[model samples]
Every structure is written in structure tokens, then in C-alpha cells.
Target: MERSRIAVAGASGLIGGALVRALTADGHEVVRLVRGAARAADEVRWDPERGSVDADGLAGCGAVVNLAGAGVGDRRWTPAYKARLRASRVRGTAALAEAVAALPEEVRPRVLLNGSAIGYYGETGGRTVDESAPPGEGFLPGLCVEWEAAAAPAREAGVRTVFARTGLVVARGGGAWGRLFPLFRAGLGGRLGDGRQYWSFIALHDEVAALRHLLDTEGLSGPFNLTAPYPATNREITETMARVLHRPALFAVPAPVLRTVLGEMAGDVLGSARVVPARLLESGFRFAFPRIEEAVRAAL
Candidate 1:
């Protein structure tokens, strides 16, 4: 495969860092779109909140991956925090799209892989959702809706836009699973809410691999649900984690306590999204770890 010049926003983030590593491994030249001081010579500093970016820095780039966004689970959903969450994604994506749109047709990157989440589907219970499923009417889904719409400029400019609707990426190193490992080892980790809500997950390695696959496969466009083939319930995930770590997973976190503790954010933890990789499978992309057990074991 021919190498391409890839520019990545949010290069400091988990997914962005993994993508940089993967792209470099695949012999692509990576230019990191940073925010603050130019830490490295190759870094392109931009402030999405301020709607500013170095457009010239993006020139000649063959591809761009927009992963800039506020951390969803980082804080309690205060009205202000929620607004920031929405603005962060919308504004950042719009900034990239605008920059790309300003470029001449031939020089502009051919593809833009924008970040999104399975939360776009809202609480699915046991109903299997794919990219073809309509957007759910809820906070997260609404957030995702606006988030994807923010990239319209790029799509209008004839760029092949891909919305990667990611799931809970399980990684041993400082990801969601890593944060829960200590608690689980101490026997404090248990199912959240009723434990019946479905939890879609993907190994960090496979998540990165899937993104690369999306980038390489020209036929893939629009939204792709980046999840494992085999979806599991919250109880299944917790119990599997316990079994993998040789610990017990008997306790359960009630919904009321979660609601009181997390407020509106509690709904996110309690909600179920039984998402499937319909587009990915149809595109002939095979999952390295299709089952939760395989993903958990690999991450552990």
C-alpha cells in the first residue's frame, strides 16, 4: 500500500495516540494538530474553542482524522459542562471541515474520519443497532447528531467522511477498563443499574485496527459502528472481568444511587446500546476479538 500524509487532531488523546502509532507503523507520515505551544516542529497548534487553526499547516495532507472533543465521562453533566461537551465536538469538527473546505479540490485530503460514539443510538436495551439504525432521541444521541453534522463542510467539499461510532474501548493501559480494574480487584466493582443493559465493547487494538481499516478501504463511507461482533450485557461484562481476574462480581450498583451520584450523567452508565458492526462486516472487515471474553482476556 502507498503511504499517505495523515494529519490528526487530538493527537494527545488515547485514540489519537493509538492512531498515530498505527499510522506510523504502516509507514505514513503523521502531522499532529495540537492545541497550545508547538511542542514539536511537526505539531500544528489550533484552538477549536476559539475557532482557530493553521490552515497552511494542513495543506498537502492526504488525510485527516478529527478526534478532538471534550471527555464525555470526565465530569458530572452540569448544564455548562454539557454545553461544552457539545461545543467541543461540534466546533472542533467544524474547524477541521472549514479548513479542508478552504483548500483547493486537488490538494484537499480525500478522506476525513471524524469521531463519534455508539451513544448516538441511545439506550437500545437488547435491540441490535447498526449504522443503518436511525438516531435515537436522547441526550447522547442528540449530542452525536450535532457532532456529525459539524463535519458537513468536509462532506460538501467532496471528502469521503466517515463517522466512527465507537464503543467502550477496553484497554489495560489507562482506558475505561484500566480505571475499573483496581476496583474490580478489590471486589468493589459490580454491575451498574439492573445489569441487564447491553454494553458494547471493543479491544483497544481492534478499535485502532478498525479505524485503519476504514481509512484504507475506500468503499467505506458515512457511519460505521466500531464495536465487537458479540455484544454483552452489563452483568456479562462485569462477571467476565471478575472471572478473568479471579475475583467475584456479586455486588450491583443501583440506579437511584447512581442517579443521585452522577445526576444526568448516570443515564449514560445505565443506558444500554446493543450495537453491531453491520457496515464493518459488510465491508469485509473481520474483528480480531469478536467475543467479549476474547477482548477481555486480550486486554487483561
Candidate 2:
């Protein structure tokens, strides 16, 4: 592949950090679209809150990956925090899209992989859905709808944009799965609620690879599910973790208790989304770890 400059927002997060490393490792020029003043030649300043980006810095880029968003499960879903979540994603994405749109047609990137989530499908209740399914009800799904729409500017500009609907990324260092490993290791880990909700998960490495795959694959555009082919239930995932770590996943967090503890965020924790990577598979993208067991082992 020919080397090209790629601008990436949110370069400090788990997926973003890994993607930056992977792109640079392959000799691709990576420009970091960071929040705040530019600290280095490779770092370009952009403030999503202000809807400002270094358009000149991103001029003539080959591709742009916008992974800017707040952690959904990081805090309680107080009205203010929920607002923060929407703003961080919707505003940040619109800012990036506008910046890319400002570029000359010839200089515009070939693709824009705007980050999204499987929450677009809302609570599936063990029902499987793919990218083709319509957006569901609830705050998360509603937020995801707006989140993906924020990239309309870039899409309208004819940049082959992709809504990268990512699922629970199983990594040892960060994300919900990162938080899970330690608890399971301590033998304090257990399934949430009824342990019946479906979890569409991807290994960290596979998640990065899939994003890179989308970057290179030009024929693909629009929403694509970046999850394992075989999604497992919460109970199945819990059992796998226990077996993989040789620890007893002996406890169960009750639904009402979780609701009381997590507040509005409990709905998502207990929601079921049996997602499938139909688009990714049909596009000929292969998964390095398609099974939950494989993903668990990788996370371990």
C-alpha cells in the first residue's frame, strides 16, 4: 500500500491509541487531531467544544478517523453527564466533518470512518440485528442516530464515509472489558442482571484491524458493524471469562440493584444487542478472533 497522511481524532483512547500505533508501524503518516494547542509537528490542534479544527493541517490527507467521544459507562447518567455524552460525540463529529468538508475536492480524504455504536439498535432483547436494521428506541439509540448523522457534511462532500459501529471491545488495558479482567481475576466478577442480554464483542486487535480494513476498502461505505461473527450472551461471556481465567464467576448482580447503583445507565448495561458483522463479512473482511473464547484468551 502506498503511504499517505491520515488524520486521527481522539488518539489517546484505547482504540485510537492502538490505531495510531498500527498506522505508524506500517509507515503511514499519522497526524493527531488533539484537543488543545499543538504540541508537536505530528499533533494538530482542534477544539470540538468550539467546533474548530485545523483545516489547513488536515488538507490533502488520505483518510480521517474520528473516534472522539466520552465513555458511556464512565459515570452515572445524570442529565448533565448525558448531555456531555451527546455533545462530546455529536459536536466532535460535526466539527471533524465540517473540517473535512472545507477541504478542496481534490485534497479531500478518500474515506471518513466516523465512530458509532451498536447501541443504534437499542435494546434487542436477544434478537440479532445487522447494519441494515433500523435504529431502535431509547436514549443510547437516539444518541447514536445523531452521532452518525453528524458526519453528513463529510458524506455530502462525497468522501466515502463509514459509520464504524463498534461493540464491546475486549482489551486488557481499557474499555469495559479492560475493567472486567481485573474483577474476574479477583474472583469477584459475575454476570449483570439476568445474564441473558446478548453482548456483541470484538477483540482489541481485531477491532483495530477492522478499522484499518474499512480504511482501505473503498467500495464499503455507510454503517458497518465491527463485532465478532459469533456474539455471545452475558451468561456465556461470564462463563467463558471464568473458564479462561480459572476463576469462579460465582456472583450475580441483580437488576434492581444495578438500576439503583448505575441509575439511568443501568438500562444499557442490561440491554441485549445480538449484533452481527454482516457487512464486514460480506465485504470480505476476516476476523482474527471471531469467537468469544478466542477474544477472552486474547484479553487475558
Candidate 3:
């Protein structure tokens, strides 16, 4: 791949950090978008809350990846927290999109890869969905719709814009998998709810690779579900983790208990989504760990 300067927002995040490392290893110049001020030579100041960013800092970059957002599982889904979630994503994306659009045509980045999630297809039940699927009903789906739309400025400016509809990433240190590793190792791992909810997951390595694919691939725009081809049920995941860790999967978190403890967040935890990476496959991006077993071993 040709080397070029790339500006990345949310550089401190789990996914963002991994992507930065991969990009830097591949000889790309990475400019991190910081919230306060440019503390380092490679850092650029940007305030999503105020919809402000340093346009001068972004000039001549090949791509601008906006991964800035409040974590979904970071806190309870109180009304205020929900608002903050939406604002964090939408505002940051809009700020970057507008900034990219304002740049001179000759210097403007060629692409804008914005962060998104498979939550757009909320509670698919048993149905398998792909990028062609319409947005599901409820808060998460609505938030995703708005989040992707927040990049209108970049799209309208003729910059290739892509929405990474990522799934539950299987990794060692962060994301949902981070919390699961300890419990499973201690023999406290169990299925959530009925253990029938489908989880579309991808290994962290493949997740980062798919993002890089989108960033580099020409003529690729719109949404792409970054998930393994075959999604597994919560029960399957529990069993796999137990077997891999040599622990017992004898416990189960009842639906009522999860609801009581997790509140509105319980819906997402217990909900089902059997998503596939149709566009990613069509684009010829291959996965290193397409199977749940392979992903589990890699995480371990």
C-alpha cells in the first residue's frame, strides 16, 4: 500500500490505538486529533463538543478516520447518558466532516472513514442481515442512522465516505471480550439470558484489517458490516470460551436478573443480531479468524 498522512480522531480508544499502531508500522504518517491542545508534534486540537477542529492541521492528508464516540457499555442508559452518546458521535463526526469539506479541493483528504456499529440492525432475532438490510427500530438503530448521516458534509464534498458497521470484537484487553476473559478464566462464565441471542463477532486483528481495507480501497463507499461470516449464539460463545479456557460453563445470567442489574442496557446484552459482512467479502477482504474457535484462541 502507498504511504500517506492520515488524521485519526479518538486515537486513545481500543480500536483507534490498534489502527494507529498498524498504520505506523506500515509507514503511514499519523496525526492524532486531541481534545484540548496539540501536546505533541503529531497531535492536532479538536473539540467535538464545540464542533471545532484544526482544519489547517488536516490539510493534505489522504484520509481522516473519525472514531470519536462515548462507549456504549461505559455507563447506564439514562436519558442524559444516551444524549451524551449521541452527541459524542454525531458532533465529532460533523466537526470532522465539515472540516474536511472546508479544505481546498487539492488538499482535501480523499476519504472519510467514520465509525459505526452493527447495533444499527438491532435485535434481528433469527434473521441474518447485511449492509443491504434496513435500519432496525429502537434507540441504537436510530443513533446509528444519525451517526452515519453526520458525515454528510464529507460525502457532499465528494470525499469517499464509509461507515464501518462493526460488530462485537473479540480481543484480549478491551471491548466486550475484555470483560469476559476474566470471568471465564475464573469459571464464572455463563450464557446471558436464554443463551440464544446471536452475536456477530470479529477478531480484533480482522477488525483493524477491515478498517484499513476500507481506508485504502477505491470506489468503496457506504456501510460495511465488519463481522465474521457466521455468527454464533451466546450459548455457543459461552461453551467455546469455557472449553478454550478449561473452565466450566455451568452458570447462566437469568433475563430478569440482567434486566434488574443492567436496566436498559440489558436489551442490548440480551438482544440478537446475526449480521454478515457481505460488502467486505464482495470487496475481497479476507478474515484471518472467520470461526469463533479461531477468534477465541487468538484472543487467548
Write the residue-wise lDDT of candidate 2 on 17-61 in tens digits.
Answer: 999999999999999998879999888898876678888888888
Instruction: Highest lDDT: give the candidate number.
Output: 3
Cα lDDT of model 1 overall?
A: 0.88
Q: What's the TM for model 1? A: 0.97
Q: Write the per-residue lDDT of candidate 1 for residues 114-145, one digit (tens) a residue.
A: 99999999978789988889999878999999
- Models ranked on lDDT: 3, 2, 1
lDDT of model 3 at position 22:
99
Model 3 spans with C-alpha error above 4 angstroms: none
Per-model TM values vs. the true structure: 0.97, 0.98, 0.99
Q: If the candidates were sorted by their TM-score against the true structure, best first, what order would they fall in?
A: 3, 2, 1
lDDT of 3 by residue, 118-156 (tens): 999998999999999999999999999999999999999
- 1 versus 2: better lDDT goes to: 2
Per-residue lDDT, model 2, residue 244, is 94
Q: How many clashing residue pairs, candidate 1?
A: 0
Q: Rate the local accuracy (lDDT) of all candidates.
A: 0.88, 0.92, 0.94
The collision pairs in model 2 are none
Residue 16 Cα positional deviation in candidate 3, in Å, after optimal superposition: 0.6
